[model samples]
Each structure stands twice: as structure tokens, then as C-alpha cells.
Target: MDQLHHQSERYGTDYSLAICDVDNFKKYNDIYGHPAGDSALQAVADSLASHGRESDGIYRFGGEEFIFLLPGQTPSGAETRLVRALEAVRNLGIAHSGNPSGTLTLSAGLSAYLPGHRVSSERLLKEADMALYSAKAAGRNRLEVAPEVRHIVRS
Candidate 1:
């Protein structure tokens, strides 16, 4: 978080936060057992790390949840990167019979720092988190950008 603040102030570079959750992870665990679940999580983490850019920061937020920070990126750029990352995971072909897709999937929420908005890192994460919940509620295996922060970006 402090890195986010420092980077923004020092470089005036836009940053985007992505909150990701393993879809139907609990069901996967219940059916596949904890060891299998751990393997699945590790696979997903590895896939994400491989797909992410060198400039991006990946973190295990907790449990099946992961967070990433995209520095010096615009909203559209962050969205594009995430879309590709999701596809990369899908291509891994990890079986998840518990999910509708029958393959392991991820749902993510993204929020970009607005240059003039003075949004705090905590608030940025909250917005991303809300968007994440919206994605899960809407249905997993997708990504959502925080609606509240949509207008913060200028064309």
C-alpha cells in the first residue's frame, strides 16, 4: 500500500488493484479434499504469476483470494491484462467439476487510481473488493471493474 502511495506521488503513474478469488473453492475443497485444494490453489497461483507482467505485484491476500497491483497502467490496460491472465488459467485445463465450467476459474475485481481524485489505497481496494463481490454474485469466471471509479479515468 505504501508503495502504491509513493509511486503515485513520485511518478504520477496510475495504479490498478485487482482482487481475485478462486471460484467455488470451498466446494472444490469439500469434494476434492484439502490436499487437492492446496494443489489447485498452487496451480492457480503459478499460472497467474506466469501470466502477469514483471511490473505487476502478485500477493496471496488470504485463503483462496489473491490480490495484484498494476503500476503505471490505465484502466483499459489493466482490464486487458486481466482478461489475458484469466484466459491463460483456462488454458491450463485444471479440472473443476464442481464449477459450471468444469474447469478451475477465477473471478476478479479491478480498480484504477485516478490521477486527480486523491483516492487512498484502502478506498481503492474497497472499490475493487465491491466489484469482486459483484462479479461473484453475477456469476463467477469473470472480471468486473469498479463502477464507482469508472468516471475517474479521462479519455
Candidate 2:
């Protein structure tokens, strides 16, 4: 969120911020085991790495989640990249005897800090969370945009 704020303040334009979470990761891991979980994580990471350009920054936010930073990128652009990443992960076809076909999926929440806008971290995270909720509600493998965007600082 800070990164988005920085770029917005510096360039006076909005950028993209997304938080991706692996769907049913815990159950998938339990079926395959910890090693399988690690493999899944690596696969997701690789997908993100391949989809992102040099300007994009990807970070593993602990387990089953990733934080993506796209500097100077619009919301639509970020969505495009995420779509490719999601597909790449799906096509990976990871081998596991745990679940049905041993496959996995991901969900993402995306938000844009449009030009001439300011936001607080709390509000930013909340919007992202709302987006994520929508994604999960829609389906296991999908992305959702925040219902609304607003500016406010965390108290």
C-alpha cells in the first residue's frame, strides 16, 4: 500500500496493488503433505515471477499468500498480468496423490489507487480484503476488484 502511495504521490498517477491467496491450500497440503505444500508455493511463486516484468515486485507473504506490487501500472494492466499468472499456475499440473487429480488454484484481490487519490493503510487493506472476499465468494479460482475505493488514514 505504501508503495502505491509513493508512486501515486511521485508520478501523480495510480498504480496496482494485489494480494493473491492460494485456494484450499490447507486442505491441499494436508492431503499431499508439507512437501507438497512447498511445491505448490514454489509453483505459484514461479508463475508470478514469470508473469511479472522487471518493474513488478512479488513477495511471499508467509504461507499461501503473495503480495504483488506493480509500479505505474493501471488496474486493468494488473488484472491482465494476474490472469496470465493464474492460468500458468492452473496449467502447471502439479503432481500429487493427495486430492482429486492433485491440482490447485488461486484467488486474488486487486485494487487501484487512481490518480489524485490518497488512502490509509487500514482502508487499503480493508478494500483489498473486500476484493478477496468477493473472489472467494465468486469461486475458488477467480479475481475480484474492490467494490469501492476511498481515501482514509488508519487511526
Candidate 3:
């Protein structure tokens, strides 16, 4: 994250960070068992990695959460990619009785670092995390962008 921030600072390019969570993961685990939950997580991870751009960094952020670093991407561009990733995971057809859709789904929150913004990487992550919570609250399987970041980018 530090490296990406530095590069963005030096090159004047924008980048976006996203935090995603598997919807109803706990219920899925409770209903299916740990081994099945682990496999489901793996499938979701693979789907996210495959659907993202090669330049994007995808990492398991512990448990059912994952993080994405999209280099040279704006907030909207990152949303486009993340939406695709969400659909890819849904299309995996992993049964999740706990989920309303009866299939695995993902929800994500995104924040972007624009040039001359003077924002710290930590703040960026916090914003994304907050947005992630908002996504979950708004009903999972959707993407939410940090309102502050979006406002800045628009201006």
C-alpha cells in the first residue's frame, strides 16, 4: 500500500482500493461446515482474481474479507471491475442456503486516491472499510464507493 501510494504521488496517477466481503459467510459456514466454507471461499477468491485486471492486486484480508488494489484506476473504473467480479462469484453457482439468492455473493466498498489529494493510505483504507460496511447494510451483493472520495473525484 505504501509503495502504491508513493508511486501515485510521484507519477500523478490515480489508484483505487476496495474491500469486499462474502455475504452471509457465517451462516453459510454454520449451515455447510468449515470444509465447505473453505472451499467456497477459495472459489470466490479464484473468481475475483480471474475477473480482475492483471494489474489489480487481490488478497485475502482474513476470513471472508478480501482486498483489491487497482493501479491506475479511477473510482468508476474500479467499480466496473468489481461489479464484474461480483457477478463472476455469483455465477460460480456455489450453493449458500443462508443467502437469499441461494448462491454465493460478494459486496464491496471502494475508495480512490487521486493525485494532489494529500490523503494517507490508512485513511483511504478506513474509507473503503466504512463503505464496505455500508454495502453490507444496504443489502449485500452490491458495491458502494466512499462518498467523500467520490465527491473529491467529481470536483
Candidate 4:
């Protein structure tokens, strides 16, 4: 967040941050046991790591949630990368009978930090979280971006 703020203030660069959660992760733990659930998480993390660029930062936000920072990327670029990441996880062929897809899946929420705004890291995270909730509400295995969260001055 400090880096993102510095990049925005000093370099006038815009970037996107995304929050991703594995769908039906609790079910995986319940049905397959904790060890299998751990393996599944590792696989998902690998998928996310493989799909992201070296410039991107991937973080585990506890449990089945993750945070991704895409430096100097626009919303569209971030969305594209997320889409690929989602598909890569799906293609991993990890079984999840608890889900409708019958395979592992992820849902993400993305929020962009535009230059010349007074946005805070907390607000950005909240926006992405809200978008994530929307994605879950709409059904998992998709990405959603919070438009209103971008380019707003801090109050």
C-alpha cells in the first residue's frame, strides 16, 4: 500500500489490486479432509503464481483468500490477467464435488488506484472486498471490478 501510494504520488502511475477467494473452500476441507484442502490451496496458489507477472505481488490473505497487486497496470489489463488466472485454476482439474462446476474455482474483486486521487489503501481494499462480495453474490468463478472506488479524494 505504501508502495502503491508512492507510485501514484511520485510516478503518477496507476495500478490495480485484486482480492481472490477460492470457491467452496470450506466444503473442500469438510469433504476431503484438511490435508487434501491444504494441497488444493497450494495448487491454487501455484496457479495464481504462474499466471501473474514478476511485477505482480501475490499474497495469501488467510484461509482461502488472496491479494494480488498489479503494478502499473490498468483495470482492463488487470481484468485480463485475472480472467486468465481464473481459467488456469479451472484447468488444473482439481475436483470439488461441492461446487456446481465439479471442479475448483475462484472469484475475484479488483480495484484500481488511479493517479491524481487521494485514495487510501484501506478504501482500496474495502472496494475490492465489496466487488468480491458482488462476484460471490452473482455466482462464483468470475471477476468483478469496483468502478466507484477509483479516483476519489479522501474525505
TM-score of each: 0.94, 0.85, 0.95, 0.92
**After superposition, which runs of candidate 2 have C-alpha atoms over 4 Å from their true positions?**
1-4, 95-102, 149-155
Q: Judged by lDDT against the true structure, how good is candidate 4? A: 0.88
Best by TM-score: 3
Model 2: per-residue Cα lDDT over 43-141, one tens digit each? 789888987899888989778888787878777788899888878887888754543435677788877676433565456566776798788888657
Steric overlap count per candidate: 0, 0, 0, 0
Candidate 4 colliding pairs, count: 0
Q: List, residue by residue over 1-155, the lDDT tens digit for candidate 4.
A: 67776767677788888999999999989999999999999999998999888989999999999999998888778989999999999999999999989999999999888754347778889999999999999999999888664334221
Question: So what's the TM-score on candidate 3?
Answer: 0.95
Candidate 1 segments whose C-alpha is farther than 4 A from its true place = none
Tell me which of candidates 1 and 2 scores higher on lDDT. 1
State the displacement of the C-alpha of residue 17, model 4, in Å, after optimal TM-score superposition: 0.3
Q: Write down the lDDT that model 1 would get.
A: 0.87
Winner by lDDT = 3
Residue 1's lDDT within candidate 4 is: 67
* Tens-digit per-residue lDDT, 43-109, candidate 3: 8888888887789999999999999999999888898999999999999999989999999999999
Per-residue lDDT for 1-155 in model 1, tens only?
A: 67776779677777888999999999999889999999988988999999888989989999999998988878889999998888888888888889999999999999988666557888888999999999999988999999866766643
lDDT-best of 2 and 4? 4
Q: What lDDT is reached at residue 37 by model 1?
A: 94
- What does candidate 2 score in Cα RMSD to the true structure? 4.5
